[model samples]
Target: MSSSRVRKEVDEALYAFVDRQRPGLLGISEDLSPMLSALDVLLAGGKRLRPAFCYWGWRALGGADGPEIIAAAASLELLQASALIHDDVMDGSDTRRGQPSVHRRFEALHASEGWPGSAVPFGMGAAILLGDLTLAWSGEMFDTSGLPGEVLAPGRPLYDVMRTEVMCGQYLDMLEQARGTGDVESALRVVKYKSAKYTIERPLHLGAAMAGASAADLEALSDYGLPLGAAFQLRDDVLGVFGDPAETGKPAGDDLREGKRTVLIALAQERATPAQREVLRRRLGDPGLDLSGVEELRTILVETGALSGCESMIDEFAAQAHVALAAAPIAAEAVAALTDLTVAATARRV
Candidate 1:
């Protein structure tokens, strides 16, 4: 099946599942409606990249296309949603995919409804529950996706590892922010487990496992996925700092505002003069940062060569991914699609 068709199927599956939850949710309280609705909205966006990777992985290993596969693949989207909602809360971000983030939406609802407590706590609490609930549902969705026991069972281990790795990666990310990125290697470690492994590599592993792939096939997919995934994240790091809000669905310099200890920032810190380092230490992570402060930080990043260095890293990883793809022992047709996916992933505008 074409990717567009798979995307459509995934969307339909997601909405259908959400609709089924309405009666149960409304029974708890009419007030719960907004949270579920907001989830649907949040899930509606995104590149559907995880599901695409999963589907292609299955296809590469000679699995046939069908609704069962699409539904199974769509489960990854819910996992992605869980990760994102929690990530936004952790970062205290106000927006995601150009919409008020789940927490922000709940926070707004709290204020607008004249809820008694502070909106911040209420919103954060609600968003956390929403993420937890979504995480559970993703597992449920995958288990009930109608793949036979043998086909689904093998993939379960990869799914389990993917979940654990992501949570651990999230903790590493939070720890870095608390301690600050002392070096590029530490920052890149966070990127590896958090974005690279969770985002691409394991999704591929899961799909390939479902198809009962050989050890060599799994190795090849990993070889292709890991570098591409890293490049994909480096591109995201670049976008977080310099991308247009309209294109990135984030405020310009949002990463600077959040004080994320990205590899890009770590490089800038390494290369910065004492005076420039002073500006970074003071302004980065300050919630009250203004436009001029953001510009100054951007300037430091450019002058110190951090921006170009990150771009070079991306190019290098992309090249490595291409070499891996060239050597992969997958079907001839799959190579073409996987190569395109590598490019789209690292070259995405949003």
Candidate 2:
């Protein structure tokens, strides 16, 4: 199926699944209505890349196109939503997709109600519960996706591993930030588990496993997916530093403010001069960072060759992904769709 069609089907599946939960939630208490509202907003904005990867992975292994598979793939969106909502809370971000982040939205709601001892705590608590709810629901969605138990059983290990890897990756990310080491190796490690596997590799594995793919076929998919996933995240790091706010949805240099120890930043830290390093230490992670500070950091990233180095890495990884894709023993149509996705995932625009 085409990407657009996949998106539409996934969206339909997701909405239908979430709608089924509404009556139960409202029955418990109407106060839980905002939980659904928050999910609706969060679910609307992603690229739906994970589901696409999952669907195409199944197709590559000769699984037929059907609502069952689409519903199974759509479950990844809830997983993605769970990650993103919690990530925003962890980063203390104020906005997402050009709107208030879930925590901030709840915080605002608390403030508007004038019935809270402290709005921040209420917001944080609500957001955390919502995130937990989505995390649990992701599993529920996948299990009840209408795929036969026999088909679904084989993929369960992969699904469970993917979840474990992402959470560990998230912890590693937090550890990196806390360490503030700016080491390229450590940063790349974070990229692998937190993003590369979760974003691409394991999703492919889950789908392929469901289709009863051979071990060789699974290896081939990994060869293609791992490099592409890395490149995808490197591109994201670049965009975080220099992308237009209109395109990225967050303010310019939001990553810098978040103190993300991205490979790009690590590279800059390695190459920077004494004064430049000092400037980086001072400006980066300052939540009140202004446009001028952002510009300064951008200049530092550029002059230190970190930006160019990151771009080179992106090109190299993408090339490796293409070469692997060429050798992958999969359907021709899957190859074409995955090729298009590689571009979409790593494109300059968000």
Candidate 3:
């Protein structure tokens, strides 16, 4: 079956597991209702991209369907959801997917029921702790997957590396925000450290290793995944400015509002005229900047050909990823699926 079809099956299974698991949460003793409610919100909506990537990696490494592998993959998806919830809180985001962000929701919950503590920080800290719990739960799920003891062992180290990589990526992102991430080289390095590897490459490696792929095969997958992940993030950079709120699930131009120094922004500065560059330098990090200014800046981006240039770069990375896949010694079917996923992920509406 195609990956989409496979995803449908897995989606149904995951939700069912989550539903069953929900009741047993926090045990019968204390009032775990709030935590469970928060968890439900976390799991309520998502693209499940991480698990799908893991699944594809396994498929590439010649894995066949079994309950244990599916459960392990599902655990990864849940962990991603947990991460996003905490990430949103850390960013102090007001909205997510066009709805209240995790901290906001928690704060509102606290207010509505008259719970104590400073709502903002309390909510954020709680969400962070909850996210930690989710990661822990994922580890537990993997341990209980019932796979042959041997099949699970080799994958553990790779899985451990993935967690560390994402945390490091988050830390790098925080650093970039604090003190500007410098030139094109530095910008690209941030892209690689903050997103490319952990989001796609390492997860692919983890899943493939789980299926017992050889070293050569794993290296080939990384070549494909690294570039594809970079392209995926580049597309996200474009969308954060140009995409519609209805589709992208964000207030338009959020990165600009946040003063995020993306590759696109860097490229725009590099190409802009002196007057245009001054406009950017003045308003790039100004939190009070308005939508009209954002639109005008976007206009400058178009006039200077920065948007098109960034688009070309995104295409280049995606193309390289495809080329790497073609050179890899994987089954034709798995390659096709990964190709489809690559396009879907980068050029996606959401």
The per-candidate count of clashes, in order, stands at 0, 0, 0
- 1-350, model 1: which lDDT tens digit per residue? 66677778988887777787789999999988888888978987898888888888888888887888888888999999999999999888999999999999999998999979799998899889999999998998898888998999999999999999999999998998999755899988999999999989998888888988988899998888988989999999988988888888988888898998998999999999999999999999988888898999999999999999999999999999999889987766667777878888788463
Model 2 root-mean-square deviation: 0.9
Off by over 4 Å in 1: 348-350
Q: What is candidate 2's lDDT per residue for 281-333, written digit by digit as tens?
A: 99999999999999999999999999999999999999899999999999999
Worst 10 residues of 2 by lDDT: 341-350
Predictions ranked by TM-score, top down? 2, 1, 3
**What TM-score does each of the candidates earn?**
0.96, 0.99, 0.92
What are the C-alpha RMSDs, in order, of all predicted structures? 1.5, 0.9, 2.1
- The residue pairs found clashing in candidate 3 are none
| Candidate with best lDDT | 2
Give lDDT per model, in order.
Answer: 0.88, 0.93, 0.78
List residue ranges in candidate 3 displaced over 4 A: 26-30, 348-350
Model 3's alpha-carbon lDDT is 0.78
Residue pairs with colliding backbones in model 2 are none
Q: Model 3: per-residue lDDT, tens digit, 216-262?
A: 98899889999998898889888888888787777877778777778
